[model samples]
Target: MLVEGIKSRPVYHGIAADPRARRHIFVLEGEGARALLEQEPSLTPAILASTEILYVARGSAGEGHVEALSALGADVAWTAPTVETLLFRLKAMLAVAHMGTRLYISGTEGFIGKAMQVALDQGMDYSTIPTEHRGSLARRVQCVHCKGVTEDVATTPFTCSHCGLSLLVRDHYSRRLGAFQGVCIDAEEPGVRPEPEALFL
Candidate 1:
């Protein structure tokens, strides 16, 4: 878990198997969690015995995994189609979630960010949450000018879909916004522009 320099990507460690933890909430999206489970078969029984798993997945990729999880006698809940609906469901779940609950999140950066936002809103501490970054590195950006969120923004120096401003996605991440701050690249000079560069490279 040693992060090197300022430019380094966040390094995430594996979730610890804490026997003392009373209630577990496994929030998983996509194939990452499933792959982890497959790699460590023993983890499934332990998870099933104590956790209430909420899975949010799109389409057939998750179908077989969901069935397998169900067969293991897991207390599972599949979220509705969209991320917004899933967030809503998570909010309702967190309304009654107690202190002993532990959160294990596995998904894309944006998906995990959204889930983490909900957890943070519910006052869940970072120590109680362990996330495994999976899927794409694509970021979700929020436009400061219009307060609009641009989802899965793969690159920077792009036009903001909301305010129609050419934005420079900053490295600074906002947990509250669940995105990097996107500022107008040409705001200072008005007509001047900076050449686009690869984001997070």
Candidate 2:
């Protein structure tokens, strides 16, 4: 089962523009574009003029997000076919980001974690970054045994994509690994394993 009480599960305060910031950087994915779209009413010309939006529209929900986000009229409004492409660009930007720059990420849990990790790699303090949950409840899971990570995992007792073992998804999340822990389910019983359950979705 997906337990929300896990201490490490991130808390999203939604995506809001920091009016005092000299620049704004938005890293969005899928339905996450909506979070930023909702901020239009609060966005001033000065803020939009210095805003950079990177969006991806391949989420479980939302449609025509690409066109919608591009029309936001930010200084840099770009869309990538996938999250990987967006992260590459984000990393380059963060490397030389100036002071007073604010980073905001909105999307599925998996997307948020991966994007957050990228910002952290560049020495950005994640606690200062604002994030919002906007899409699927799917998770990024890492097999404790093989140390292999599986993305968008929405089920419990799911097979680990790497080691081919039936794994029980744990509520335990690892910020350093950017994934939830999955331990082998039938390790003790060998051939016995419970049926898969769609818990995280």
Candidate 3:
């Protein structure tokens, strides 16, 4: 998880079943399914019937909980083989989603950001959606120089996936880009790089 007090960090206020919602859309990845599963007690049979669950069983923090997610009996519980497939399905689902639909997302920070990006693109106000952070704390980082995005960054002083420069992952985040900022760490000295730290995993 990112350090507290980072002003740009998205605050996850957790998710709950909106009793009045006619359609409930849950997008989850890896161990994030637990965020929805744990709320079974709060979900009524009718609410569960109207719910649609999309889960990615494999990711940075896979828990092999596809069977468990299916057991929840959401009307359209489907597990995608990959994240790309999941996003494709999610976009389609959101396109025809009704007015009373409520979007909920849970996953690693990277997955959360990506899902939120999709929701935002579909004209959903991010502030109205409920989000829960779960599983790996690995970050999605963007190199300032080449502007290439590197996913699942668990260490500090990592090499930029786009540029060859060594980078220091910063706490500053960009919700629009859905990534954390990574700056060249050895720009001043050119060759001096610190030991990598496993700060987010």
List ranges where model 1 is wrong by over 4 Å: 1-11, 44-46, 59-63, 77-79, 194-201
lDDT of 1 by residue, 34-147 (tens): 634553455556656776667666523735766665555655646456767878888898889777777777777777778989999988875567888766677788888998
Root-mean-square deviation of Cα positions for candidate 3 versus the true structure, in angstroms: 2.1
lDDT of 2 at 86: 95
Q: How close is candidate 2 to the true structure, as a TM-score?
A: 0.94
Model 2 C-alpha lDDT per residue in residues 52-165, reported as the tens digit of each score: 999887753348787777788899999888889999999999999999999999999889999999999999888999999987898899999999999989889899999999
* Clashing residue pairs in candidate 2 (N, C-alpha, C atoms within 3 angstroms): none
Ranking by lDDT: 2, 3, 1
Can you tell me which runs of candidate 2 are displaced by over 4 Å? Answer: 2-4, 60-62
**How far is each candidate from the true structure, as Cα RMSD in Å?**
4.0, 1.6, 2.1
Global lDDT scores for all candidate models: 0.70, 0.89, 0.88
197: Cα error in model 3, Å:
1.0
CA lDDT, candidate 3, residue 116: 85
Candidate 3 TM-score, true structure as reference? 0.94
Give the Å shift of residue 85 in candidate 3.
Answer: 0.6
